[model samples]
Target: MSKPLVSVVVISYNHEAFIKQTLDSLLSQKTDFEYEVVVGEDKSTDDTLAICKSYGDKINLIFSEENVGMIPNFIRTLKAAKGKYIAVCEGDDYWIDPLKLQKQVDFLEANPNYTICWTDYSIVNDKGELTKTDFGYTKDIIDIDFNNLFTPYSTYTLTSMFRMEAFDLELYQTLKHYKDNSLYVLLLREGKGAFLNFVSSVYRVHEGGVYSLTSNYHKNYSSYLNIKEIMEAVPESRSKNMKRILNSLGNATAFGLLKQKQKGEVLTEDQLKFMTDYFKNGNLKTKLKYFKRRFLK
Candidate 1:
């Protein structure tokens, strides 16, 4: 068959409970451009593939015999993408606004220099209900400058879109599991990106889901290291003051590790230095102010 208009890659592994909602959400998009749904069912023991097959001509699916995990499966599914631009919506996540795809497409078409775009997302309970959590990541939308990307923000893959060339093979090989942040960094490093501001998707938080179990404080440190490493690889990135931003992140993580006794997680000299140098270089007044609020009675 001829190339499809848009490639919407959806990764699923044992998301049988929520896959239907995700599919329905994609089928309801209000874009003027044509699009195809590419499903990578990564060895789900559940009925995820069976459900996908039920859609037949309406959707395209790829079922694997072995689980390739999140990053590998995501990269694998993109091989089938026939659209000039690729959009992503994970298995458990669903888009709330039907105009989500249309908005992103319009922005990319109008701005050729920008290769990436994303909107804000809201958190939802397991029963498909919105939570008290925030829907906007004002930190990112306000300014997507390189420094902004380094700082922690509300950005998530469910609300983001990237052009096909967002990552090169060399970069992808270097960054394996941290695909989400890697893609964000690559786009920010190369071209301008837009923050749609509108809350276009619902990021579901099941009691048994990912964010609920993963330690946020721990992940932040590792992510900071990855960003530092990538910056070092890109010579032009030095102009963005990437090193200072990473140093600040290390300082923040040092305090975080101190609170949880995670300094033990510092396995090597590099990890130890990341914590110590930041601590030694930390501003005295700032440190004192922090201790006053945190320790003083």
Candidate 2:
């Protein structure tokens, strides 16, 4: 009769080979508080749906009749979720630490100013083999804002846990077709974001991944569009933050254009100015890197 303290939303689509491990790892979490696992199987062409069903009553499963794509599936899973805090781990990825949920929940409960918390994570191959490389924050706990958070791939999705009440549902619906970063931006806009120093999850990189399937240019462009949407979503009252948002967008667009230039695409004068300004206004280390690339041997 009581609601769970946290809702773990797992979105699956043709992740038959990985769903079992993902679910197992998720349900393995040892928590003092009650947490529900909401699995949204988006009509996977493979045996993903069957595997999810095998969990039976252990998880709240929503099996789609047809493939509704990732964004729709994410939204559907979010809708089914009922918890004070929402944690996400795609079917292709799995949680590494059992305390991930409890730790994040505890932190959010203690810190009213922090809206979201994420941990470090490892990268795994399609075969579930761990790669030597890991993704984590350099600092033990980094407080991030909209301007610093808009860059692409700054954090892993599986490691994220956010407060349910911090977001605007109508604004979130506008991002039904956008990537995870769009939601990340909205969460950051609500309050500060924190990163735990410890590794708590594993992100699987394979041909089936949403961004992995596309070219670098496509991913960059998609990130660009997502940033623009966030800019539009920003309230007019927050003019200062809006300016920083524009700066972040400009920096991303400039870098994306540079990538295009490498492939023989010509850059316009306006685009060049954007890049120059990014380096000029960047921090000391960033300015040094730019100078080294521009003038040094």
TM-score of each: 0.80, 0.79
Q: Tens-digit lDDT track for model 1 on 142-176?
A: 44646566444656788877787765646766763
Candidate 2: list runs displaced more than 4 Å: 127-129, 132-138, 150-153, 236-297
lDDT of 2 by residue, 60-175 (tens): 99975678877778888899999999999999989889999988988999999999988878788766688644344477787767545633244678999999899676787866
Q: Which of the numbered candidates is closest to the native, going by highest TM-score?
A: 1
Off by over 4 Å in 1: 132-143, 150-152, 238-245, 262-297
The lDDT values for all models are 0.74, 0.78
List of clashing residue pairs for candidate 1 = none
* Predicted structure 2: lDDT: 0.78
**Lowest lDDT 10-residue stretch of candidate 2:** 235-244
